[model samples]
Target chain A: MDRINVCIIGSGNWATTIARNVGRNVANSQHMEPIVYMYVYEEIVDGRKLTEIINTTHINVKYMPDFVLPTNIVAVDDVVKTARDADILIFAIPPTFVNSCCKTLLGKVKPTAHAVSLIKGFERGDDGQIVLISQIIMRQLKIPCSVLVGCNLAHEIANDNFVEGTIGCRDQKYFRLLQDIFKSATFRVVVTDDADCVEICSTLRNVIAFGAGCADGMELNENTKAGIIRRGFLETLQFVDVFYPGCRMATFFEACGISDLVTSCYANRNRKLAEAFVKTGQPLSELEHILIPGHEPLGPVTAELVHIMLEKKGLADKFPLFTVIYKICVGDQPLTRLVETLRFAREDM
Target chain B: MDRINVCIIGSGNWATTIARNVGRNVANSQHMEPIVYMYVYEEIVDGRKLTEIINTTHINVKYMPDFVLPTNIVAVDDVVKTARDADILIFAIPPTFVNSCCKTLLGKVKPTAHAVSLIKGFERGDDGQIVLISQIIMRQLKIPCSVLVGCNLAHEIANDNFVEGTIGCRDQKYFRLLQDIFKSATFRVVVTDDADCVEICSTLRNVIAFGAGCADGMELNENTKAGIIRRGFLETLQFVDVFYPGCRMATFFEACGISDLVTSCYANRNRKLAEAFVKTGQPLSELEHILIPGHEPLGPVTAELVHIMLEKKGLADKFPLFTVIYKICVGDQPLTRLVETLRFAREDM
Candidate 1:
């Protein structure tokens, strides 16, 4: 096999963290090149091009300010140029930008290149079906796409704190290669063959985190928070089974499943925003704007998508936790109904 | 078909909470008698018999102060008299006392009686086999046994905070009856048939909680703490499959499994002591003596039993988390090795 070239297709906090991991590994790895190209969507940072600042200072000052990127990681403003001749493509951009970014990479990347999506959340198709971010990348770029998901907080990963991530890939060879690129002493990786299950779990956990935040905002006890999370987990499994059957039950036990959900519920932007939504009686949009400026909070939006999908299948009633979160977000129901809805739903189950 | 007479075989905090639940429910339930008998090991409280004080004041002032027992619950000093003629028995005392309590009820209890164990630890047999507390009760009293386990912190349940518990019973008929006794609006119960799995999970969780506390005391980040918990859960499942095959995977999804484990790791006496052990370098015995006097911290002791059981089978290496916890508690290993042991163990897996 020829030496592999690696490219990260986003310049966000998570993307920067991935760059650090890959950049460090690729330096000594015989299978890949030392240089890692990160696609930077050219913005002005401190009176300089963001890409230039990243290249010169070896830092993603805008998104991940404190962490220093490895010197081997190069920044490219053009998506096509960044992805050109790359053997490994890592997609860590927001789901909203995946389509546009994939369009730029269309027919530019090598045919043999394999991709791993660090992107979470889903996109709505023309027929109103949920499309995973990885699916979009694979469809547009005509390449095999795997996914990585877990309880990883990007800052913690950047700081070299111990964490575990799950890689969901069908191809065992690619899975091993991806594991080599990402896994470190502190950043451990586990692989599974159920990509769809892992991706779906990653998307749905934001909604669960929203519910956990509501519990926190309402001053509900830890037991109630845990109950909501546990129920949310069961519902996530059920949703995957109903929509994407044949996924293994053990997949939900992986880092992509219960571990990620637990971390998001206890600590995350979604949980924080939802807690503020209940405590301040403010809209989620306003809180998102204040808490995480210029970023779309995925939980409420994903809840809306899930609500629509469940309704389309005439199974809205079966997913009360997701439905209640969607309703509360859209002002169709009061926030106070969150815990009661979950409790009653469990009884019905 | 007959009215069930209820008896509680302990007067500790948990037993008091169960008594309150049954006492309240039985009063309005046609299937059970309103009068509930509680076996109280005789003690002097404020110059009066503990049983007399409980009967007169409707409060277990010594064990569960600030919570009132239902007036219909009558306390008895004699264990045999408490067990006599009772159609339903609940064993909520510590495992150390289970043998003596069951010995007293050996032939005195009616054969028609059914029992559920709210006990949370294990006993070792002569040949070093691990024994479920329910097994002891069943062998001694000749009755069907079911188990209840979950994140029901007694104080939380007593305060009417919402929580869920799982009942594992193979007998569907007895399952429904036990649910009726335990379930309330705030304290919801879910039933499964994997009684042994549930019992094993309940017993092993204390050891996991100790590991979690060691992580906290070592000042590991939340992600690492969550990592330890997730690993502990996987080990729990593996332990059950190795020791008790034919247990359904879905059983771990129930409240008795994941929910209980999460609760114990986050907030419990064992976790607290283990945290202190790491922080102060004190033996578990001294810490338990100071922190929770008269109670053997079940996690360390359970770890010892699990270690013995696993060592007996020559499979001790398979469960590093359990082994390391037991070693730390027994002064065989240093406290600092806990996280590294868990991390390396995952790699080996």
Candidate 2:
């Protein structure tokens, strides 16, 4: 078997985690049949002083180091030069930089290379389509690609903890290859050919995380949280089925969707930031700057998602959690009212 | 439509709450409909004190109240002498006493009466079946019936708050009749034709609530509690399907299952008591003897259910949360472990 060479673009937390996990697997193999190369594109921040205020993560070149990084890497610079020679190229850049980054890396990367995406958000428009990070790259580059996403990334890399996620690709070979390459004791992965399902699951997983964060910020009990996750599941299902059908509903039997939704809502830093902002009545812009700049703004994406459900889909009555989350995000409602609505809806359900 | 007459049997806190809520609805109604008749079965408890409890509850009874002496209320008692004309007969007695209570109520109440059960637990043995309170009555008396259950009665009535719940029957006419009878803005009730689902939802709601008590006993988090409720949903779907395959799985989509589970796990007093015992590291037997005898002993039922799931079903590997919750109940694991397992299983999902 030709060793699969997996190259990741961006030195973000997600990018670093996948590289470390995959690289370690290849290095530890007794026979070393297939060599994996991880290319990290670290942007030059003035004086390397960005870490002074926020904090910088160390990437482990040792591959599976006891402390930081966790991967053997042949790190590279500049998107065009590094991605030119790779079998599989993964884009883990923040959604905000997706368009510009795609423009720079498109033709330089292998034309037939499997393009994998991990970005999540909805591009603003009259018809507002949910855009996968891979789709954004492929559209700009004029190439076809697949996506791999779900719940395991930052915590897995930063905390050296075990986490499970899903891989999605329309191509069977790429899906299987990615699944086999990434599967490990600590990092379990499931492969699916349902791009739409994977796309929706990946996208809403973050959106719902914001809702879960609101639930957490309120210190609501399990019953309320369970209802929130379930309702979130239904909301995603409704939106996906309305906009893009035939995607296998990935969460019908799986724990990743519901559990991940809960985790994101409660523990995810991005969501926690949003929740804190809402709780303290901070300005939306201040909170927006803190969260992962998903597409335009995290709060608006969430608000618009809820708005679409109510206005377009007419599902506001069915999913009070979605509406509550929207109201909380926009500061239109208090947490108690959200809880009351949820309770009222629960009574009605 | 004819006003439905409701007769409640048993005088525990649960039974009293149901009676009180129903009484409140009747008192506040524009017309005298769904008139509630509360019955206290005291053949087991000494007669005098049971009377005292009944009298105390009567202090605020806005509706007409009836008290039948213990001996005369037996099956041998004239069928019409006590509840000859009642419409709905509620079995609110403890699970252990339900079988005998059914024998006593059999033929004594109206043959056409609709049955509403409030008990929560299963009859353990070769059958290993959830002997629903109504089922025991129907089986013993060979009568057809419906059931109403889900939320904890104390939370609904004593707390003077709305607790989400469901009413289930095989017939639509009976379902609607019960719906109209219990319809209140505050006492929200969702109706379904899923007898098996409601029975399973109600019983498992208690079992999980008991588990929640265990979680709270040790001071677990929203994450751990969320995990338990999620697992509770899975275990519920599993157990209900195993026992009653034809039941509509959509019932899991209702508040009675998900929302009810949350309240049972987070807000119920029984779980609070169990949490206290767990925090103090008291023996389960001692705990049970002190606080569990009068009611259905749902706390112990939850513990036993956890044992069955872990030791007998061998589902710990697949549903790791169950394993962690099992340890929590048995004192072998910390509540933190339960939270960790929940967080991981979710990440894994």
Candidate 3:
């Protein structure tokens, strides 16, 4: 069999972590390329190009500075040059960068390449439908794109901590191949055929994590917090049922679903920002500026998009928690009223 | 409609919390008895019978001292007299005492009564089958039995913090009645028609909590802890599939299953003691003596019984987590090998 050439299309902390895994795995295997090309977007960092610094120091100084990357991961600045002739393309860029990056590699990627998206947010199409990053990548590149999602905190994975991720792919051959590339002693991967479910779950869990944060900021007891998380989970299930009709309910039990939601609710920036929103009585935009400067809190944005989608589909009434979250984030409702909102929301259930 | 007389057949912390909900709900409604009789095994506290003290002070000072019981919840001593004409029996006693309590009230409980078991542990039959507490109640009293289980921490519930519990009942009438009695502004109930699944999840979750504790004791990373929990959950699903064939897969998503497991793994005494076991290298019995005084850590006992049952059916190999947890608790295996054991366990998956 011909060796599979792997390329990573991002240079963030998560992207570097993926490159570390792929670079190490490929170096140890005879059936894959020993070198991994990482698209770096050509940034200057402290008198040198970021890609040059990464290739020289084997560290991502901006995002993930503590861990050392595998030596074989060569960083490239040009997207088309980086992705050209690759058999596997791993997308780990921010959601905002995906479209422009894909435009640069529209027809440059190998026709037989299999893509796996690690992007965590969704986009709204012109028709007002929520578009998965995988769908966007597939639409742009004319290749089958799957999703890799779970409670994978990059720092944890970098520390060689035990973690599990779900790969949502339709092709069994790609599933096994991706699993082989990603699965290590510490990082385990499970595959399912519901790519849309995986992507949707990864995108929507931030909203639920925000709800958990709101509960925590209110100083609610553990039971109440657990109740909010559970309610958020059920609402997500209901939303997926109504919006993504063919997604199996059991997919919600997988790593990309409940596990990711649990982790995000307990430990994530979204939860922290929402908690700050409740504690300080400030809007999410201000909270994001203070807590996570220059980065958008995806929860509120996703909640707004979800609100629009639900309104178009006449599902606003069906998802009261999501609606209330959007209202709270947008300053239409006070955070103090969250408990009562959840109470009223549960009554509908 | 005839008024339903509710009798709570235990006077522990959880029982007091249940009586608090029932007492308040019944007092506010005309369809049920305003007075709730809670059977307390006669014990002397400060030279007075425990039941007498509860009736006078409205507190289970021994078990739960922080919260006051409702005024209308009268305490009784005689098992038969307590449940004599009751239309709803809430069993909150430990499994060890259930048979003797059932024996004393075998012929006295009202034949038309419906029962809900709040018992957390399971019983092993003479033939080595896992006996659900509800099954035992149904056999002893010839009444339809259901279960109330969830992430309900007793003190939190008593403090009037918001919480949710699942009622697993095959009878719709009993489900509605139980929901009415238990539901409040702070305490909510969702009903499912899978009583066995509910009971088994509540019982088996202690084992999973022990696994969580073991992970905590070993100082595994959060990702590892989450993986153990997810794997434990899947194993429980597999166990339910084999032992209780008709249980719905969706039942595992309910409050009784994932919610309860999450809470127990996070905060319960079983998880704490198991963590101590790994930290101090002491057996659970010794740790229980120091940590919980006289109470048995039900996780290990349930694990033992589950182990024997699985061995009898030659299915022990199917549940490696449970087997390894049992072995770890019994000193047959070291706690540090937990990650490796879990790794081997997932290979079979």
C-alpha lDDT (0 to 100) for residue B329 of candidate 3:
82
Per residue, candidate 2 scores C-alpha lDDT tens digits across A121-165 of 545444653455666667887666676665533544345343556
Best by TM-score: 1
**All candidates: TM-score:** 0.96, 0.77, 0.95
- Binned by DockQ into CAPRI classes (incorrect, acceptable, medium, high), candidate 1 is medium
Candidate 3 per-residue lDDT over residues A172-241, each given as its tens digit: 8787789888877878788899878888988888988888898888888777666667777888888888
The 10 consecutive residues of candidate 3 chain B with the worst lDDT sum are B340-349
Winner of 1 and 2 under TM-score? 1
Q: Pick by lDDT: which candidate is best?
A: 1
lDDT of 2 at B342: 45
Clashing pairs for model 2 are A3-A34, A60-A69, A63-A71, A63-A72, A64-A70, A212-A265, A213-A265, A223-B262, A256-B349, B217-B275
The number of the candidate with the highest DockQ is: 1
Segments in model 3 whose C-alpha atoms lie over 4 Å from true places: A341-349, B341-349
* lDDT per model vs. reference: 0.86, 0.60, 0.84
Residue B270, model 1, lDDT: 91
Task: Tell the DockQ for candidate 3.
Answer: 0.52
Clash count list over all predictions = 0, 10, 0
